[model samples]
Target: MIKRYTELADAVEHLLLEKNSEFICYLQPVTSREAALQWLAQYRQQYSDANHVCWAYIIGNTRQPQTQAFSDDGEPSGTAGKPMLHVLTERELGNCLAVVVRYFGGVKLGAGGLVRAYSNAVSQAAGNAELRMISPSVQLSISVSFAFEARLRQLLQQYQAALDDVAYRDNVSMQVSVPQDAEPALREQLINETAGAAVIRQVASHSGV
Candidate 1:
């Protein structure tokens, strides 16, 4: 089962220092694997002078994580990326990416120190970010009469649904996206409101918002 997940509202930054070495961590919001890679590439290019750009990301639905990847960026075998990945996975974050850019100072942090620094950097950013819950929903298309349009829209509010698309023809055609759990009740309400005139069909399922 998946708990509620949140998106990072804005980019977050955290800094960790060990023996004069500066680790600048960036937490960026990413909804897809492609987006994650794109953002990482942008960061790498922007910080081309930095020592290392270690990164990790979790992309998928609330119920299940789809794709995950982490890179050490030459930090060490098990130091930078894996610890950052652990923080994201343990929190069950959705569509999130964690990148820690290291600017090596004169000192060298050991493997354990690197692990703690990387994990703490991501964790601190997560704490400071604005997270939005990932809501699971189903897409549905409904057909109803023009006269019942207003009522159908009202019923959507009560049924926890959102209106996606609508068309005015001989009758009214609409595409609505409703919560997966509330579909049954929403469908029942539609039938009663339209007096059997409303037709509802499941179109697709969305993993998260």
Candidate 2:
């Protein structure tokens, strides 16, 4: 599954503001549904005086799932939460929490206007903040004779594998991070380049940041 690439934030004026109605959007990084819920609680307390708190979250690294919650605090039901959640899920973002707090003015926006306002708030926040993608990666460790260390390093660089660590001795021990899909090709290239003189080990799988 594809992951979110960056976090962003933006703001827009409410289309039907009577007197100083304000909406504040908060975006944060979250790894699990529990974390997202905790964030929702915290923001609810932090903005206790606001009229409404609406939130949405996408969780999991791959095959992500989505959850959303909202309180009108007196506004019409079904007007605030669903639209905000829609924005998050539509973008296929994961491990993230988005909340919009509203302070109502004397004027009343119809159901349609409420949906537009809440959705617009989240869309603006997502658009302006920075985001990052999380991908699956694997680490490969290799030991090579000193004579072949330079060639190995060059080959790793050519493949754009991140050199995690290196140790120098009679043989060189190097750790490299490669995309999960590319691990087999990397292993073959290393074996061929060192002419079977190198011993390679699969270290561990990691989430690529």
Instruction: Indicate which candidate wins on TM-score.
Output: 1
lDDT by residue (tens digit), candidate 2, 1-209? 23333322222222323336777877677776788788788988998998887776666432445444445555577777777777776664456677888888777778988888888877776666655665567789989998888888888877668899999887899999977767778789888977787898989986666
Supply candidate 1's per-residue lDDT for 30: 85
Candidate 1: residue 170 Cα off by (Å) = 7.0
TM-score of 1: 0.80
How many steric overlaps does candidate 1 have? Answer: 2
lDDT measured at residue 59 in model 1 versus the true structure, 0 to 100: 84
Q: Residue 37 of model 1: what lDDT?
A: 96
> Which window of 10 residues has the lowest lDDT sum in candidate 1?
1-10
